[model samples]
Target: MGRNTRKRRTPLATKAIAASAALALGGGGLIWANFYASAHESNSGQNQTKAAAGQVATISCPDVGQKLTNVPQRARRAVAKELANLDKQITEAYARLASTRQAQTRDANFVQNSIVGPLKEKRAASLDRIRLDIQRVGGRVNTSGLGSLAPCTTQPADQTNAGGGQNGNGGQQQGGDQQNGDGQQQGGGDQQQGGDAGQNIGGQAGNGPVAADFVDITKVAANVQGKPQNGGQASTGSFTTKCGVNANKNHNTDNVIVAPGVTNGAHHLHDYVGNQKVDAFATNDSLIQDQTSCQNQGDLSAYYWPVVRVQDGTQDFDQNADGGGKEGNVGKILTPVQAEIKYVGNPQSKVVAMPQFLRIITGDAKTTTNGLANANAHWSCTGFEDKVQLTEQYPICPQGSNVVRTFAFQSCWDGQNIDSANHRTHVAFADPASGACGNGFKAIPQLTMRLVYEITPPTLENGQVKNAYAVDGFPEQLHKPATDHDDFIAVFKNNLANKIANCINAGKQCQ
Candidate 1:
């Protein structure tokens, strides 16, 4: 198939043909009926385009001879069992293909290259295996049905019910001559599992920020008129806690939330920096017990989020490209030059322990267009301070300095909930003018993260560099450099929080 050629109607057409055969056979007919009806209903519009493009093909099931009258009863039973297994496997392969395809938003080429092609190969191999098994049983296996398998060409019209159904068992002929028994494939088993799994897989590809009311950093910065207030002079003691290199152990290529029960995480890939063991399935209680890579053994906090990809143009990071999703290549996973933990007294000059299970988010992951929402999602250079800007276009840092990404979370807490509905309501930024907590809020130790990367200069395309760095993000954002964001969760025990508080309040710089 050509790189741009699409096979959108093949899978559905195949399903429809299979359903017709099931109806004729009088077993498992309802299962196929339901599958065909759902698929057709969801993709009616796309089907019209598929028909016009002449991409749909007619598939016919071959006439495999019924159980041989002269064949031994035992042989008949064995063949029936083998055939049933093959049918089940074929059904499952298509079901999985449908589910995965629905989740993707990449162009036709990408579906053909990365996803559809591989799935087709697996199905073909399974069919071949089934043919061999039938030959061993002195039965002739018809291979005519194999020609219709093809790649998906068109994008699905609606994905609301993408992973809704499960593959049902194909009805098995009990005895060679007897009519096929009415076998009802169990429902609610695999369908529920697939739906839940789809939900847990991360990287939702869509337009702009997920939240409707996200605040831009530029606006926040502009609102502040004076230097950040430290409230009052620090007492005599202040302390610093440093966490050692906790390289993200769960370096998952699939960006889905793997936390227990929550399977859907990120759809696009993300570089998880801290808490090596962090995954989609991680929980507050589990994180508190996990050992810290921090030098301070008592601190067991977890911090992680998506990664930044340094795109030297020509790389297929474009979301519009055929066979492309977000960034085309996985890109390099840059380690932070430095990772540490520190607690500082809030503007009130009072250091209070952070509440356990506190979940704070810094920067907007969904800010694709607005520059203000990405103010704190900073990108800077070691020497070129004058070139810093809030736009998605990143400057080519001078030869000496590497690119730096700094994310700072809110420091004031509401003192009640460990986490709010939006992950930000419980915490608010300190007053830009006074650097003090708001009326109902209390000052807590501040958490800041700095991720440094050694990005090479952009590769020129047609005598000009168009896009240099492509940060990982939703497909709708086009992998724009500005959508970068980070997350932090406080899992410190009360005793540890108190120690951090004492260290900051006492004005001691202890690491």
Candidate 2:
């Protein structure tokens, strides 16, 4: 007779116990699972499960092992239901802790003493009950592993605080360097200055924390104006370009670089469109050579920045004030539900060729701290153009309308420089009234992007929406509703730029 070929009934709980042992022995596991447990100490000098006065306590567990194939369907469902309840309880605890804010120092104490301590005790009791349930089902429980919880001791502000570094435009180029097809730097050299705009302030490399002193220019109401209407004449011609959705698949990974040698991609995620191969190390030549997601094959520009997330009150994104110190623990990334790109120009004048490799940042991403700069960042309801607001808090759209994020790039460019020491000096916004180019500035094909989201309007409770929508931002930002920002780069080929110019000046609408 053939050897019995039946599979053993290995319970999921047993496998989980074995996996926990394997992880302990190898010291190679998902760090985020027990990140706070090992890295942070409680005020009590005990494990993270016990806090003294003002500390953050955390509960964590290794992931359950591989799914049990031999388990009966009904039993599996029961296990899932129990696990979900536990998760919900933990999420509620976190929300309660987040809502209780006093003075920063006092708040820490209240959280550690009142919130974390009670939650830890409650979790321990729940785990004991779960162990009994698993045992009754013929499953072995890892009591020690399930009981693991930790408390985080509060450190001094200067010691534990994280801050973003100011970005300088100067750097030496490495590797085989050459100019791109558009005569822009392919590699090696300090960041070139396009005009006299000064060094790019707040241009920190990578996804680092925003500088505490950083100011957002967009929030300044004085700097912003209503959208300009056609200035000199009607458009002679126009061309429409359709770009594909955000393309950075590994945006959640911290390994991606935003600038050379800067590993800032992982702290916050960005939505990249245009170049399919953009990363921290992408170069002008590499971008030009790569395929674009845009329908206009000739248009090869890259646009990206931190993405936004809608806070519907039920989700726990780990959006702590200290910029969650743990790696890979950044909040979730939400893709844009819809995106539109368009270029417009004056009917009387030809749209001039944009300088190669020109960098433009429209909205300030760090607007949560500096409210004045928000003036330049535009937010509005789809049908309520008259209701535009400069505040970071997104307005609830009227019935039948959608939330709109509009970004209009500076249309005037210095003829010579592609970029300046500060990214802005090379490009200046057109005059608001006449839509006329500034002195010594030539008009280029105007770039504008509108992003629409289908997020439901958050209901106001006690004069505040508990979990209103928010854009992705530095960890220290607390995911404030006002911290939206966007970036753009001009990589148009000489021929394509001329074509766009011809179409606009000729009064022809060509897609």
TM-score of every candidate relative to the true structure:
0.51, 0.53
lDDT of 2: 0.42
> Candidate 1, which segments miss by more than 4 Å at Cα?
1-226, 233-239, 244-249, 253-260, 312-329, 369-375, 384-391, 459-467
Q: State the lDDT of candidate 2 residue by residue for 1-511, as single tens digits.
A: 1111111211432333243334323433322112111111112211111111322322222212111222232243344334434433443443343223223244436656775576667656656665666666777666686566322222222221111111110000000000010001100012111112111111111011112111122221221223445546544465677776574442432212223323443345567887566665667788778887787777787777566544321222333322221211132345666677766774234577666677766544333333222223455556543323323335455556666666666667778766542234556665544556656777777776777766555443211122234555543233333455567776665477677777877777776
Off by over 4 Å in 2: 1-236, 247-258, 313-332, 347-349, 370-375, 386-389, 480-482
Question: What's the distance in Å from true for residue 154, model 2?
Answer: 17
Cα lDDT tens digits, model 1, 1-511, are 0011101222432343344334323432222112111211012211100011111011111112111223232343343333333323333332333344334333435445654566456546655654565567665655655324323222221111111111110000000000000001101111211231231111112111111111112111111112343546532344555654335434443321222232223434545543455665566667777776666666677766665543222222323321123222223444566554455556555756888767776555443322222224455555432323222334355566666665546777887866542344567666544556675787787776656677664432211222234465533233434456666767665488788777877777666
Quantify all predictions' global Cα lDDT against the true fold.
Answer: 0.40, 0.42
Best by TM-score: 2
